[model samples]
Target: MATDKPCKNLHRSPSPAQCMDHYGCIYENNHLITLLVDPENGRIADANRAACEFYGYSLRQFRQLLICDLAADPKSGVQEFVEKALPAGDEQSNRMFIDRHVLASGEPIDVEVHTGMMKMLGKNCVYTVIHDISERVSSEQRLRESEERYRDLVELCPEAILVYSGGIILFVNKQTERMFGNKKQELIGKRIEDFFNEVYFQSAEHNKLKTTGLLKERFRIEQRLIRRHDNRIFDLEISGVPVIYEEDKALQLVIRDITESKRELERAIRLQEHRHAVSFPLDSKAVLEKLYIPARTLSGDFFLFHKINEKQVIGIIGDVTGKGITAALNISALRVMFMDSLLSTQNPVQVLNDLNLKALQYLGEDYIAGCCFLFDFGTGLLKAAGAGINEFLYVPRGRDCERITVKGAPLGMFESSEFEEKSIPFESGDRFCFYSDGMELLFNSDELGRDYGYLIERFAGAALQDDCTWLGLNIQ
Candidate 1:
């Protein structure tokens, strides 16, 4: 039951020191405890029922203790907190402070201490209220650890991470400079839509396209912007999503290099056309297949098959190191050298020496390394020789392979390294093969799924699936 009580100032009896626990006294009793000190000295002050429960100290026990005696911290952490919280000029006021309290049983508890100034019996005094907030400290520590873990995860991603809001960049990872060629400081607060093409920027289509992963289709366009420092345009593709940021929607973008993908697509298109461009004149016995894999857009392998005489057929096979249009150009020059030297019935070695000198005159010292093999099908005799380019050899199983060694220094290596020749007999049904370093490097990846090498082997001994020339030399 609850009752309205007369005010203490209205001639009511002085309040008892013990907690009343009655409804009328509940609010005051919650923060009050009896004073257990002697009258004159004010030796000690009793804690209230709420304070007793808070500090795990009994009212009688608390009344025997002084605040100064209970507050001395044996541990440095507590003392440091008290010093920062309770500076000078803070004694008599209702100062908010944190302190450590050692109870009668010697257990220490952390507290937020609130002090109130008071005057009792014409003596100056202070009433203190202690509240525990240990759970808050622990929760703050856990929140810090969770934030650190999230930071570490963001740092470890291989691609460049960009955090933005409302199309303006807010944060960027270290890889951003490598991918976008811009410093993080220069990028923040910059509109991300500036990087998008005008066609996609008008309707914010680039921003929407990433959600569907379709913006990558315009990776070709990103190649246009050159970096300020090196003038090297990045072959980068970006994917991004919109998220709530600072209570508003922001976008996060991630970028990856797609240069190799662009090159592969170009090569695929060229190879499709090259397949029909080169072939033997008349069909013979063996099914001829050649696999041509250029380390770049073009390759170093070239061949030509034509009638040398009324009854004789001539065939040539060559491998050149270093590629692109340059190596392809050297392959073209080799054909010219073969035509010029072929009329003399000279050895394959002489033809290459002539070609090497021509390549040096045309391409300088960095031109190419190569090997050339020729066969006169009328006599079934095959002659082979080479320059610096090796690891490329022919293996003709069940018959003479006509193995050839890299003889001279790579064609572009020296102005003059002698070309030496070797010969072997070729028979019907013999198969010869050549390969580039990219062919063997195809399988060197952590991801062990289908790869370039796996696809090449599938066409092995059946028919080639690569872009190169296979001169079919057989009897009609």
Candidate 2:
């Protein structure tokens, strides 16, 4: 029960002479703990029945105790009140205060004291009313602690977190501070219009109205906003939720930065298109016909055919260990290495050996399966080598295409890796096919599995499923 009300509302005993007139009709009740005290010496003149029961004391014992005796910290609050609560010529006659008080069992509890000046039996005195507020104060303290933890969590979050009401900022996390390059103080009470462009401002307004007006609980969007310091705009993925903050409806927003990822995606698109739109110079005499199909946006299959000199022309086809951008990067590295090696030597074995060493040095765990061919127009002899690749196809002037057996380990695997070289006497009307494993390993149809044996039956024409790169050279 709380009794921190006007003492006049409490029942007063007639024996307390001065209080009898003001509280005579009250006449001893237990609902309120009321007290009459001599203000000059902080002495308790009288206490009602409720006060005696509340303090676990008899009426006479209560009257013997001073007002300061009830306080746990007498010096901090009680002494100050006794000296200044009712100074001379003070028009402010009433005072209310909260303090911790000790009960009869020596246990402390929170209390609110309402005090007012009064004339009791022709002498100045103060009336006191007490209320127990321990439970209420404890609940408030717990709420404060919970709020502190919530604030810490928001401050330490990795993504930007913001709370706003009516498009006005209310709170911003540390990540939001760093992202916008502004302190939380600068953002609080500010509108989104200060940071975002007009387009984003309209979008935010639209989302808020859609969420609050339509009773939507949450919404998400991707947009761009400018940084505060440099005014550089970047992409953001924003997620918003409706919440009550500071007793007012508000919006909670979480922002994720996606500028770098978006840029990388655009760059990859450009690279993939560039790689797909490849153009090879026409070679009317070599009878070169190439076919390339990519399994993805970027192809793991790559082929290169260049005329090294009048006596020799080098052609190669390869498949990197994996697909997509990683394989594409490795293919680029292979092209650079192959071009560098071809500038000095035309031997298929030496060229492959050089590439193998470079692959081992730079390609890490990834490897390349490739076959190299050097055609000598001057001598009508074709030299061939392979590394981690399937057999090459050879067609004589009037003979069926046959697989040429070659031996080599995959590049980037070992330092002592070797490639086998074979020479075939070439005639004027001969054809050779060089292709990646995608051709044989690719699924053609469920009826016929990935068997290169089918290639011998349909050497003239065969369908491919996986990424395939093939280069054909007709001996001129």
Candidate 3:
């Protein structure tokens, strides 16, 4: 070890030789990879034991090589680093550089080099401390790759995705660009509230709560948005979740277009209303009145009255097993079949049996609770058959009301279902009411009455949980 130069003050009584020996011992035995380089020519003047072992090179071989020989990039050698690291005053300056270095084994490794000015044998030199940062660099590179993959997934997503911070748009996916009719470059850095109507913000307080970190959980809401290109307003269902994006708290919004769905809903409402608005045959002499109330936009309850001639009318009232479009479709199919069955036979028993066969073929597992009745003004007799609806209200002239029940299984349950038929004598000034099961709230067997007006008033005020339909026939 060369120890001619004295070290900085170690103690009061330490001699020059003793200080030099102490400095050499620490420098050579240090655990950190250290090197002494000639600042003028980028030559490696000396290397510590740690440096020799780390680079897989002997001390003599390291001394024979220039500093640029170890550098992965020859342009960023020690001389350039030392010149940039020189201090303005007499004070020693320290600088840090991240670069790649090649080992004696010809393997490239990432390194963080800390350089400072120093003197060795009365010549200016640069003392460098090297730290192997391969692991840290590898971790950062992996993180970048993961972020890139996440961005690709977001871009390829089917729904429109938007990321915003403090109500200012930070990012938007390709679907968002297509939905808003705007380029991503035009949308990014813009305010999110500009495109959406007042429905999105709701109130100033809601907007504040949304932009701030107070709302952290996922939430969904429907709002109207205007396209930037054509200014066309459309409905959108937006679901938002709070996320950490680019080290900042942001809201990631997933949006779905619900414009077509809303339109279909409106069309269904109109069709259901038209179905409820029943038009009785003008040629029929009997006074027929009905009240149909649906709990939802679509009703499963249905009633149809077909006037056979001037004195005879055949009618059916039923409730399908389920709700919504499926039930509505079943009701329509059954109505068409009922009309066709009446053409073949006006008998209540044959009409119901025909309908049961059609229901089994068309309805699959679904069923219908219904009653088919034939009223004959010519014979002054009413014939009724029950499938699932087993009861009817019978009011005789100047006599007490009676609950007439004809019991049988609902349609579509069995291939050979046997329905029971009932015949009752009727006269002038008597009345009858046929209703679906939804009217059970007001009319049980014991509550049979002739006052249809009062029952309708009470039913109008009640909270209906299902579809209700009732048809009244006054014997005129």
| Candidate achieving the largest TM-score | 3
Report how far residue 51 has shifted in candidate 2, in Å: 1.7
Q: Write the per-residue lDDT of candidate 1 for residues 183-297, one digit (tens) a residue.
A: 7787887765444343444444444532433322322123334444555544666666655555655556777776676665566446434733666543553344444444324
Clashes of each: 5, 2, 0
Q: Which stretches of candidate 1 lie over 4 Å from their true place?
A: 1-276, 285-287, 294-299, 310-316, 319-346, 389-406, 434-476
lDDT of 3 by residue, 1-476 (tens): 88676666645696678767987999999999999888778788889999999999999999898887988876776555555545443326688888789999999999998888887656787888999999999999999999999899999999999987887888999999888777999899887656655455766544742475655788877666676557787877878888888889888888899888667656655666777677656334467777777673455788888888877878888888765666668787888888888879999989989989988998899998899988888898999999999889888878887889988789999889999999998987888888888576556644446466766676776557787877777777
TM-score: which is higher, 2 or 3?
3
Candidate 2 stretches with Cα past 4 Å from truth are: 1-27, 76-79, 83-93, 119-123, 204-216, 228-231, 260-476
What TM-score does prediction 1 earn?
A: 0.42
C-alpha TM-score for every candidate: 0.42, 0.49, 0.59
Give the lDDT of residue 416 in candidate 2.
Answer: 93
Write down the lDDT that model 2 would get: 0.74
Q: Considering every candidate listed, which one attains the maximal lDDT? A: 3
Per-candidate Cα RMSD to the true structure, in Å, reads: 13.7, 12.9, 9.0
lDDT (tens digit, per residue) of candidate 2 on 31-145: 7888888877778888888888888878888888888888898575445666545655463578778878899889898999888887766888787888999999999999999
**Reference-based lDDT, each prediction:** 0.54, 0.74, 0.80
